[model samples]
Target: MAPTATRSPWPRVGAIVLLLTALLSVIMIAFAWPATRSSVHDIPIAVAGPSAATAQVAQQLSAKRPGTFDVTVVDGTAAAERLILDREVYGAIDVSSGHPQLIIASAASPAVAQALQQVAQALGGTDAGVPVRDLVPLPADDPRGAGLAAGALPLVLGGIAAAGVLTSLVVGVARRLAGALAFAVTGALALVAILQFWLGSVEGSYWLNSGAVALGIAATALTILGLESLLGAAGLGLGAASMMLLGNPLSGLSSAPEMLPSGWGTLGQFLPPGAAGSLLRSTAFFDGHAAAPHVWVLLGWAALGLVLAGLAAARTARRPAAAEPAAEAVPATVAV
Candidate 1:
């Protein structure tokens, strides 16, 4: 018989190279696109002054960067400050006393604050610098909020790692899940301590901050664990990729969500990473204002993951029972 032809190694090698290239390209786009395309688009900012002055200021802002700022006219600076504290606005342009003053909440978003500062400078023309007041300043040790932004990736990676370890090392579904939860709690505590006490990135009640971090880690780890339990190795890969690629880049942790082009920012807030970052920020600085929505999102993800895990566990439990009858029949046949 004629020998069968072997497949060419070059084709397999080429395919691998192509696949790797495609993956790298996607990763680059995910991480770089948002940052490069970032710009102010309908970002909420209050204007506090008389009707005529506020209208003119609003018109100028629109003319300068059309559709950039969603200008809300308020009665006075007091009203504007309330909105900022409530997380309704990023910053405000106050012309209440016939002089423009810039009120910023740097803790909410340092990027937005810087943008507003530039706008404030422009408003002052060449005469003098605009009077600036930071309503919510970041911690003295970490004034840029670099630590807080940098902390987001580690949390995501830690949760992914937790899921991997539990799935691989733990024997039963219940045990794996318990381990994941325990890791979430302990990991959150450790991370929060480092960020809060050591790095000075986070502020507010320690317990509250720890709780936020724990919930975020739990939501991520449980979701990944559920996927792994249900679909095995493939499920784990899917979960990890989704969290890293789709969730992390769109998280808006490094910058305000509104800064992202299109509606991706809003969509990010619905995902685990984004929700976690926003929730943590709120708890740390805003006293939990505007935190309910993010809390619900995380809870929803965790609940769904639990349901998936239960289904997988049920399936695993049934396999042994189904196999028992076949084994018993095998002994009878062997005796015959």
Candidate 2:
């Protein structure tokens, strides 16, 4: 008589899945965190104190950190306002008089906006004079500051695909490369079409749109594939956080780095998604101001990814002699 083997409850298995999901979630979020516990240096801010005051503020910012605040000295208050409207600087200060004015575009990074408000308050010291208030707010529907989101889309999509690929890699599983790549490319193109046609993301030739979208898709997929080959599952989380979160935030999504928080603000141009987005936008709206650099960046990512994938595959290649096991020599008489 054999006793029936006891079976474990399915609830424990569910708990383990849930636990893993939660752990991954935690790790991913941590990787994407952009904030320091207390403060960030080099935020692009507008200082409009008097010529002396403005210059002083600009100098103070530059002195604090390189690539933090660009500190443009506008012609006058109206010019500054226009800059804000055009999504130029985050906000402008008007230290034209005894008091100084603090301005901010709420549509930009809320953190930077809050930081500007704090700066305004600090300037309200007893020594500071009367202050005027002017608001160059973001569009009502632009809370996420998506006006600047176009440029970062490539990075975000790239990361998402990378993460998906990486998750599979973590399990020591590989999906159909062609199928996944095709899907990835299709999704990117669809997004580009939607943004360009529906959202009026660009005002250029259809060829340009197609080219830009295709370039983005190719670069993103290649980068993810390359990263997965190099870093395995971990690269997925890292690339996602790097391209999507940090790259977008640092790329002047809402306002240019000139108005970004000190330090990381100046870093906007060099970041991948940041650079790619700007280049695409320039080609879309403007006439493509020196797009070669950005094109190279995207190409570089794609190329690197491809190479890594090849290397990964090569590493798993069957050895030439290993496949042919040695055969025993048969006697000549046995041939008959």
Candidate 3:
């Protein structure tokens, strides 16, 4: 019998790459999305005074504003002031005096402080004597009143950068789909912990944070995987470009979504970064108020990716139409 021929190994490797790429891309996108940050509400503020007084005030504030601020109780006004200096509280209340004083410290989200001021003034006399000042002040280089521009932003962006680079490596040639997914999930969880618990960007429910992290990674990866499924490796570049350049700044990562151009603010939620960012905000700061919208958006993206990837595989199995070169003229007349 004639010797059996060994098959070329390239197509097998390509198939493996595509599978691994899909799973890995899903994970990477999840980590790239920033955690929740509301330009409007749920700012952390410390409260200090007699337990009775502070409790009443906190209850009153929540009752009036509902979801605007989360009041964290401190030992005393001194402690509240200290928390402000430590960047722990967006604003503070000292109910020690006959007319309680309000302290607004965080410059990053002055609207939060301003909102608190209105509430405090409505309850008490005036924040005119409440001593509103910037304690752990914003850097001169920053224009955003919030100091987050310098500190938390770098930390957040650093996490995204690392995730992207590592994802590129793992997804480029890996053949294990589960491993790729694990890599992305782990990266996003680590980043979520850093920002939410360790770094103090937010304080919220653990399940909410976990969900947010999962969505963040899923959104980024889905977009990337969709492109790769359509255009192979080149799609990775396009996805990265869309996420880092077009998505971040426009998504309002450094500020409130509404603060950007009107159209951008409205449409940012449609982008992966925007969807993830909104999802993060819902868990971290919004007290799950707007969670439904973002959940559906990210979930839709994830589902779309799965569907498209499946279709691409099926399409790839079909043979493309064969093209034949023009017939030779038999050297025109030489045959005769």
Candidate 4:
């Protein structure tokens, strides 16, 4: 050990900066690219008319954009409307009339509705325009979908913030959980007051919307907290990455799941953000018709998070006092 090699701290610091820069770049690219390149992928639309007309319309649409529209043939307009309300299809075309009529659920997605309008117009030709009707229109107050689209980000940020605060301020699993729950309830109420009452963005039963928001916040916060408890710093990083990188863009809030790049949309629905968005939409517009699954998803995440936190606490409590000495010895050896 006559000539010990001394490593400069600058190199380590520079490498960390470079690595972080690269990571940020990757994240930015990953999120931006998919959103910019978004196109209709297997969007479900029904054709309600005679068998011949239905087949003709379906074939024509398929010809225009191969694999873009999943055209289902229904007996008549009533059947199509039923499907739309049931959340089976986004829009439906009634070729039963001389001029085609497009029925859309704007509550589902205005962008998709516009796209369907374009398709219907194209089919009907320039002279005979396709008459478009919105079955489930968006709220008069929030017609542009700005509110619904913007909802997910706040919830995501709120969850992360809640987790960060609770982890730093509170100790013990039970206390952390209680903090998360408290934050969720209060946060939901506050958000509802701002976005729903003041801004008039969110429209629905106040209690239902608030409850949905609370569940979403609780699920997100508890999940992050659980991960932190179980895996320490690494767990927090993982949770953040999952929510930001994978969950955010794939959420399908601005568009329907079918509008996203195939499997990615479906994948997003399994996450808390997507589930939350869907649940909120259902509650707001569909009168909670298709909200059970989304509710279950949120509940499942909350349950799992609680379980994980409990296990982590129990494990920490059970560790022997002698193990602390051994753990300290290992770190000392590593430093040497």
Candidate 5:
């Protein structure tokens, strides 16, 4: 023992430093890339007027922004309004009167509304007013959508935190599942109360909003819980990392999915965070219109989590039974 050489700590220290550096780089990219690169891409908008005028306007939009807007040409402003109300489009350019008027749904996305207003101003000439109409206005209290934007990250964090606690402290798979679900339901209700009543961050049916929030929380917590059950502590890290790093940033809660660069936005919609945000908005502002897709995405994730958790639980149960049989056999052999 006295002659044994001591292991160098520098190697371990260097490895940790390198690992931290890599993690930092990844974190920076995940968050910064979305914010910096956020711009309109294939954002659906309607152009209402005669075919010739609408075509010309659409062509100008295409030429000016180039692939930014997906223009839906409608004969009348009424049709364009219908599209916005149905959640089919973000905003509309009503050129039906030969003068361009921008109809935007601020509740759908303040950022998109602002951007459309700017485009309208440019189209109508800066010297004249753009004649903007907010079809779906955000709550007066949270006019800028700051509350909803700020709330997105917390929802992800809350689910992760609940799952972590359950994994560490709760015993039995059934108990863990029960605890996560209880938290999701109760926590969502409480959070929604704050957002809707206190902060005015949301509108529409309170229970519906709570349900949407609960579903999102359940999806995240259950998925992480199942991962931990199967892969031990590493599973927790993987799940949390993916949710916080990938899901939260790409959620597009601050703006709109189409604002994110190309495919990333669509990818985010499949994740818990993005699905949750979209679902919440639909419930809050759009009367649950276009909510079926987000609901399905969440359901799929939650189902996957349940299947994984059940498999892990079955494996765990088998281990104890197998050990018991082996122990009994060993005792009998020794006695004989």
Candidate 6:
């Protein structure tokens, strides 16, 4: 009887299945828990008024929800508005008048604005007379932020799709790079056209929006491609997990990061999707004031991806050529 094969594929298959199951479990927990358990924690807000009254109000608000706010006392309403515009604070409360005034930049986050309104109302003792003002309101066309929030998932999906297509169909480093660039430009144009021009959700310089979207796509594509080049198929799995499982839900595109559960907001901001979302928001609404750091983050990821691709290409180039079969005719001479 022929010797039995020593190695079995079953164990490897089982291990892969087990690993994937564990990964899925982790992904569900990370995403679901934060979303379900979300609450205010250390959200920055300004309380603007006479120093004594502002301090008292701040103290009261903090007491009501300890660790919910990082309250700063601003001298006046103008100062608070400036902070909001600078993306320094989400909302401001002015207790100078007989009725408390809650000032919010709804463009920054409608959820945050709503929360501030609730807090202000609570502070007013159920008389229900607090005036909530939206200093930087969202576009009237997309008043509920539905359009912008809806854009995030598509952007992520588009990046993943583009990368997957390129890796499957394209060959050679130069060709892949070129394909990525072309896709980035065209995809950005189409997405911006739909979201900004047709839907009117995003309001900004057309060129600026186009550039931001393009950079985001390029960063994502390059990173995925780089991982594939360096680590083969496993790299693709890791990339998908990072971009989809970890990045998307934590992104806080539908709401401000500060509005999410503690620590998750900051963690999300460090990832590409979060950075892209923040950058897009700045370009569309805030006149690109706070977009520099996010831009840098995207660029950094792109650079890292390019570097990995280059290294992989170099390694592939240096691989030894396979040996050809030996000439068959020479074997009979010795027996003769």
Instruction: Please write out the lDDT profile of model 6 over residues 159-198, one tens digit for every residue.
Output: 7787788889988866887798788889989998998888
RMSD of 6: 4.7
| Sequence-dependent TM-score of model 2 | 0.54
How well is each residue in 1-336 modelled by candidate 4, as lDDT tens digits?
A: 599888779989899999999999979975886687789879988999999889888888888889889888998889999999888899999977755899999998888999998888889877678888999998788897888798889988888888888888887778989999999999999887777887777777888988888998998889988999999988877887888788778889988777777788898888888888888888777777788898999999898889889889888887876588888777444554
Q: lDDT (CA) for every model shown?
A: 0.92, 0.59, 0.60, 0.86, 0.93, 0.84
lDDT of 5 by residue, 52-75 (tens): 999989989988999889989999
Arrange candidates by TM-score, descending.
Answer: 5, 1, 4, 6, 2, 3
- Preferred candidate (TM-score higher): 4 or 6: 4
Best model number under lDDT:
5
lDDT of 2 by residue, 1-336 (tens): 999999879999899999999978865653343333224455545665467778876765566454545577864677776666555566777776655777775644555666666666655665553354535343344344464465465545654665475456544324534534565556656666666566654455656655655565566556665667667767656666566656666666444454544556556556666556656555554445446776787777767767877777667564544555633344345665
Question: lDDT (0-100) at residue 159 of candidate 1?
Answer: 82
Prediction 4 TM-score vs. true: 0.90
**lDDT of model 4 at position 220:** 88
Angstrom error of the Cα, residue 297, model 5: value is 0.7
Q: What is the lDDT for 11 in model 4? A: 84
Give residue 203's error in model 1 in angstroms.
Answer: 1.1
| lDDT per residue (tens digit) for residues 1-336 in model 1 | 999998779989899999999999999998999999998888899999999999999999999988889989999989999999889999999999998999999999999999999998998786687999999999998999999999989989988999999888888878988998899899999999999999999999888888888888889999999999899999899999989998898998899999998799999999899999999999999999989999999998888778889999899889999999988887555555
User: For candidate 4, which ten residues in a row score worst on lDDT?
Assistant: 327-336
Clashes of 4: 0
The residue ranges of model 5 lying beyond 4 angstroms of the native Cα positions read: 1-8, 321-336
Q: List the residue pairs that clash in candidate 6.
A: none
Worst 10 residues of 2 by lDDT: 30-39
For residues 193-275, what per-residue lDDT tens digits would candidate 3 score against the true structure? 76655655644676677666666666666556655666776765677666665566556545655445445555767766666
